[model samples]
Target: MKEAAKGLVPASSSVNEGAAPLVERLIAAATELRIGVERLENGVTVLDGGIAVCGSVAAGIAIGEICMGGLGRVRLTTSGGAGAAEGGWPTWLEVASAQPVLACLASQYAGWSLSASKEEGGGKKFFSLGSGPARALAAREALFDELRYRDHAASGVLVLEVDRMPPPVVVDKVLRDCELAPEQLTLILTPTSSLAGSTQVVARVLEVALHKAHELGFPLADVIDGDARAPLPAPSPDAGVAMGRTNDAILYGGQVHLTVAGGDEAARDLARRLPSSNSRDYGRSFADVFRDYDYDFYRIDPALFAPAEVWVSSLESGRTWHAGGIDMALLRRLWLDEA
Candidate 1:
């Protein structure tokens, strides 16, 4: 492996090198379950990488949680609830890590929106959010600037929430941007419509909460520990529908408990402003709001992306504030009322 560039510490010296180990764990777990894996001649490892995985039962919950920012541990589980109203869906996934701030905030939410510009072989455009440990390498987004988080690893794993396997052109672009050789990179693909895809997306309850807090201008550094849950919606016939259900699970059924350093007053403000209900466009399925804005995600209210309920504990003051609760009426509406 190349030495760290001048003035930079070796990857060994930095604490940020969590992606490599977690990728190994994810691979082992998936392989034990007979989940599909592939290694291309270019040394790129692909997990659930193609249409062959479509409709195939996969280790969705396990595979999904493993891709988070150097996960401390992940639990892929199902619900105690019975019936279709576990609505929109039944599986629930959760993660707990010692480095909750890094794992949930910097790694999992997948803030990077990678698009092929005309110069990068625009003949056919490709798009996927650059996430997982590789984002620490890419550090392309504005959030990275504020978080002051970055990593340099001999090997890296990245998770892409896209249907198609990344073409070599795209893969090359990522490797170049991350400054890693193909052999050192592992790529996992999960489409929104796939069983595993929806499972993982729903598993992002904690990430959604953190993202919401970040959007509300809450200092994320204050967040100490987080645990969250949302109904795992079933994969739908349409990719768009599956996406909608997973999103609604978070928007209407997801719940979060955040332990933070802030005092009660600050926690109350966060609690009051941090649920999907706080948004003006609160009562609709994500697909509806998305389509109403012509499928332009940016057009939707950013606040609507939060969990349905939030509980904040002020570690500094020993006070806890709970705001919002399951919006089952809205969830049921989104579940059965899908147009």
Candidate 2:
């Protein structure tokens, strides 16, 4: 019988033993795909952390789990999957008990929001903000300070969602920031266009809502659980097109439900403010905005990065406030354009 690579985390573990750090699980996934790990020189390497470079539906599930920082459970579900197999299965993720703020908002989704870009050694040097628990160890972003959370560990694992691999200098900075040797660091690479990549990106629906809540002064600590769904688009040959379609999944079709304990008014206001549609950059596909900005992410409006709709149910008051709705017309337009 074919089995997962040895030493990988079993599907079952003692709950009393404490959950493993998300980065460790990510590395296990990398080890499972060691043949798919592409080693680069200069003490830096590029590796397939989850599914192989060209991944599978199961791999997409694993990737979604990684995106939740492993605090959340990601699974393939048939919800809204009627005619949904446009080449990929549907997925859902849920999180509770762990640090959702640190796991998803700071460590996972918020890391690469505005990454560093530079040129060194006479060649272009670019580093997407590293994701996963390693970002907590690096504490490289203002979001880390705002959250007062950081991870201290011997190993620094980073997940980068980019079409290009990191150059040596980019690798060096992470090593220094996390105070780890080159050999102690691992980078999991997933481009925005691949099947795994798209699944993982749509997987951020919950994080998007949480981050926006934080931005709106909602007490994120009160958010006890979260789950979300977004349509899975088919893989595309063009990375840009794939990226656009995936963002559309979130901006147009994604729906996030968060359970929290803030007052109904606060929850309502936060929910009211938390959708991509609230941004002035709404109505147009993300591809259109990317093209208008010449593909520079920073140049685009930051407010536009959020789920299409958010539903917040207050645990204390037992009240739910919902805002926004799916943009099916816009979603279909993007899909037909891609087709």
Name the TM-score of candidate 2: 0.80
Best by TM-score: 1
Model 2 C-alpha lDDT versus the unseen true structure? 0.64
Could you give candidate 1's per-residue lDDT for residues 1-339 as a string of tens digits?
111112111223222366566557657766454446789998899887334655333466655555565563556456513323444344555555545557766677677777765466446667888667677777778876777767776777788888766667788878898898888888888887887777777778888888878888887667777887776666786988988999998888888888877557778999999988888888878898999999998889888999988889887678888988786667666565456
TM-score of 1: 0.86
Clashing pairs in 1: 89-233
Off by over 4 Å in 2: 1-35, 38-46, 49-52, 81-98, 110-122, 336-339
TM-score of each: 0.86, 0.80
Candidates in order have lDDT scores of 0.72, 0.64
Native RMSD of candidate 2 (Å):
7.8
